[model samples]
Target: MRTDDSGALDLSDGDPILAVETLLLTRDGRPGGWRRAIHRADDFKYVFASNR
Candidate 1:
């Protein structure tokens, strides 16, 4: 989750600003890597999915 320049979580009438960092693992339970991601939302779907 993230906040605006004023440090406020204004989710209405504002830009979607959320930064997420996640770790990845290999199929054999090994450390694959990690990545930083950002998402933009302008709809009300009430669901979030990542197809990476």
Candidate 2:
């Protein structure tokens, strides 16, 4: 998601996005503080969801 110029967290390198996705996909059972955090991309928000 594109952030406004003022007070924006720069994620142009995509590392933050990758890190968020990895954490969402690789966690074991039971939730933790990291899992409880809000993950977002541009204007889109993401959640840790499973088909099972």
Best by TM-score: 1
Q: Each candidate's TM vs. the true structure?
A: 0.39, 0.18
CA displacement after TM-score superposition, residue 37 of candidate 1 (Å): 1.6
Encode model 2's per-residue lDDT on 1-52: one tens digit a residue: 3454222545444434422322333367554434322233455655788899
> How does model 2 score by TM-score?
0.18
Q: State each model's CA lDDT, in order.
A: 0.61, 0.41
The CA lDDT at 17 in model 1 is: 52
How many collisions per candidate?
0, 2
Report the Cα RMSD per candidate.
6.8, 9.7
Model 1: per-residue Cα lDDT over 1-52, one tens digit each:
4345324543654667556688899999898999875555443336678999
Candidate 2 least-lDDT 10 residues = 17-26
